[model samples]
Target: MPRARSSGSPNLACRSATTNCIRCLPQVEWEAPMADFLKLRDRMVDIHLARRGIRDSRVLQAMRTVPRERFVREGLEDFAYEDSALPIEEEQTISQPYIVAAMAEAAEIQSDDRVLEVGAGSGYAAAVLGQLAGEVFAIERHTALGKLARERIAALGYDNVDIRVGDGTRGLADQAPFDAILVAAGGPDVPAALKQQLAVGGHLVIPVGDPGDQKLCKVTRITESRFEEENLGAVMFVPLIGEQGWQEDGRRAASNHLPGASKSQSLPEMIADAAEDLPGFDDPAFGRLFDRFAGRRVVLLGEASHGTGEFYRARAAITRHLITHHNFTIVAVEADWPDAATIDRYVRHRPHRAGTDKPFQRFPTWMWRNTDIQELIHWMRDHNDMVDDMEARAGFYGLDIYNMSGSIGAVLDYLDRVDPDAAKVARERYGCLTPWQSNPATYGRAALSRGYAECEKAVIDQCRDLLRKRLDYAKDDGDAFLDAAQNARLIASAERYYRIMYYGGAESWNLRDTHMFETLQNLLDARGPDAKAIVWAHNSHIGDARVTDMGAARDELNIGQLCRETFGSDAALIGFGTHTGTVAAATDWDGDMQVKRVNPSRADSYERQFHDSGKSRFLLDLSPERHDALRRRLAEPRLERFIGVIYRPDTELQSHYSQAILPEQFDAFVWFDRTQAVTPLGPEHHRGVPETYPFGE
Candidate 1:
């Protein structure tokens, strides 16, 4: 997330003993120096405006005055002066210098104008606007980014800026009547609130349309009653996520308090309404569906390798919620019982620093490290007497220790000792010495070892010892594992484990393979009628693929195909994608590229405006063979305006490649009469030119 500029200094009042001293301090140094900054800034302006045909001077000057280096990450300060977006925390990005300039210029800011900026990332654009406008109000949705932006702005001493934390699409309704609005994020359409908030003659500049294609549109209030819309150029941005934007979709399954009644409403509406529901207390039907295992006996299954932050956060939330608010009696994490016994002792004695060591440093296990988990454990321990009583009444059973593979190993060792009839199966399945080598033959060799035969006898003795120990301390055997419950949820860090385990083999683990869907289906089937499960996965995995080609199935079978085969009509799924602008960067390139921005001629009709001008504008559609060849040929950066094409195998090959072209590879595009290649929306409106047959007009 980009940081915002902070609001200025605190006021001070002082009284002197001998004399009355009253003075206002000099305005804090909020404004960064523009002297040495202007040169590099001007160089960027030339690259974007003069070289790339950015006609808006106000945009250029704003770019010039605002020191972009101040808003960028410290390491990326050198590239700050360049016209390319940089990644910030949370996987968000600060817009490129030219894009900021172009967008700000398109907004048509005036000296006394009040501007509203959506996606207040890094506060770079807001800082620039502070120099151009009277009041700049920037909204950042991400809470952390919002705080960072406020800190940066305060450091720079920008007094004219007001940073607000809120959803951007909704716009600050209380501060209605903005002279101009700039949305940094992309959306499928201009948000209605932004349009309504624009004062007469105000301009709203935003990138609008689908993720694959978007237009930087400048909407100006032409009169009190009408507005003029001009397509500026093509651009890409992150999706604008909020109530008024694209919604996340998925199924919600739990105890039915009227599940059938809520089925008629749209999934988007459900998600929007459910946003207010507390994490643990949401209505079971919808909340449990999205959250998964809301009020159930869950055994969190963790892999040795930790996953991404999102996965960690989700698992943590689920574990916390279950322990705090459910009838969950037992938690069986994958660790050995002896290791868990040590953890239990640590939790009981050193509550604050329980198991705060390697491997056990994850949540619940390392309870002392996390304040929330520590508090929950304290509460549970305090009420242990009552829990023990309940356990006695219910005839509580101690958690069973079954390290599926380790148990198999123990069984194999026993088979070797007894020379049982099923000894071959044990040898083939559980005799491997190397933990990494899971082949059946290795298991057989291990089962045949003399050491394995001895170990099998020892394993049975150990189980008996554990059982006897439990019986000796039998006052509340059920409550013994309660301390471990915090870390014990059957949540796998990698979905691949679930796929491999359920499929009984590792042959179908490819992300691109449709077998992934089959695995999910098997998971659903295994859950059975009494059990309900929610899958937290990418939009491609859960969405109905038949209607939309925007999911993973575009590379395999559509979402609808999988849903029908696996979930049937009983399961509901939603697909979500952020529509941040169009392709600003080349698919294969790392940095940003400067593409020419063209507008429709006033004299030409909407359709005729799609035609080629004398200026260098051409579209090139390449065949698969040609595309691969051209990609290697024009791998270097060059000055040209052309659209690029990638073959979509899921669609009919000819139909998919029919209008596909290498626009970046060509000098200019011409409309081929025979191919009917002119874009109905046109390159001028859609951001790239249409492919033509001949080289020139």
Candidate 2:
């Protein structure tokens, strides 16, 4: 265990006596004067680096020295140094200390290295890198996170670290050479651009694989033309959304054919197998359905999960593939359009710095800060032919059906001007009736009262009163609002309603219907049908044929239900599988190749014991068939080497929704065979196998 420095001693007296004493003191003493919160953090670092076998001394020292408490919300100070990850604004997470240490060690940062990190959440990792390396360049996609990171980094006096708000997959090419790059999120594959930016001997650490099973991987640039790969281990993270990763809207159909099937086989045999297992094929009329786009323009919708490195690479790959193979003329991203001119100028002229007046000065940092969803602006500006005729021919739009909670007030303000009647209803509902006759109910109140009206009036009156607070640019400021409205109009012209697509099945409302969702939905709805769209919500919404089965085609519905209803045939969906073996790097533990069991839910009986100690209420409920399968496999361990279980919450209600069970959602599970473990189970034995069409292509 790491111990705190002694509270008082001659060494401390000498340390405080002169400034030079501190600079010359042993590196360990730099952590002495930090708050107790940092002391706890240092202790955790010791456990992570020493016990966990993180051999990079630079990484360990950096982890120990950086004050994590300074990077989180003030209220969450106590948990600042905890081993578990914590939620930040915009649903992003500041990764746990151990995970950060592991990622940093994996990158193998050298003393004079320059590092580029994607998803600079909280700037904690960047701060750690600042201490370990010569310079750190970090990018955060979310504007709020970018602003917060800038503030925190400056406050900590980390002059060696620089942050910008931008997409990370489009690596900062202006600063082409980076010794190491660490992508904080999970993406489908390594991004080609990032690979190009890596210095000759540099290493790139990222997580690759589908969402279900991600393997940490390090790609090292051996020579200018050669590269080597090493699979590190397993991890779970949010999707990476950018130009190179998998876009949510792009759908690919996988076909599975049986082995040894003769061409002379009867049509009935093919139909029988197709109905039983294969994914339904697209309608032959698909060519006619999209005939309108032959001479006219085409706009593609790209879905991005902006923070994960894996998703970013996937989005980029998908974009390149679409442009190369599919003749996609115009690509509309989930970025802002107003900043397009600036992006175009940068791409063309390639300014080295923004000068003294601009908020960001460094060219590389500026490029990273402005290229995410914001890059859509640049794309539209450069490709004017795609969006020049919004009302008649083409239009660019953002399909961000979900809302960030903080933007509710802004949405309500916009609604107040655009649709006063709806605004009035919202005000009355939120109980914002006040003395000035303003609407407070717009904020979302279960019930309304006269006080709400008074509050609403007061708010509006205060805004009016503060209108001239800044007289010089007041009219120009008003024009800015007009510009924003124009942008909203453009977004509305293409689609009316914002679709609410959910990853988890509809049975769980969790964060989907919260204030943020409502705010975003209303904002998009305010735009009107050019802006209207069908939400591909979870199965819970569309599974109940009675509720969501309306006459509208291509409207709001569950994907699974939509496929079944549209095709009236079985369709295959691809999911990931996990394999266990030895990783490339070794430390204290032997790097052995063995069957490792992987499961979707990390929680097991051990965690349950802490939650419920007495009678062990929760049992791993297995059906009769499943129990029999387990018994048979247990008898012959060698025959049942690896087990894969498909976890469908809708099918296994008793297993997932029992009184003792936790209501977490998981798509599938994989278990590795160990010395004492046995029994392999297939889809039929699992609770929800029949519901999903499996295509292992």
Write the residue-wise lDDT of candidate 1 on 31-150 in tens digits.
334554566577667744455556766666767777778787765554465444666766678886667777777777888999999999888889988878999999999888888888
Give per-model TM-scores. 0.35, 0.35
Clashes of each: 41, 59
RMSD of each: 26.9, 27.4
Whole-model lDDT values for every prediction: 0.42, 0.41
Model 2 per-residue lDDT tens digits across residues 288-403: 32222222222121111112122222233333333333443233323233332123333223222222122122211111232232333333334443434332221232222212
Candidate 2: segments with Cα more than 4 A from true spot:
1-34, 248-697
Which ten-residue region of model 2 has the weakest summed lDDT? Answer: 636-645
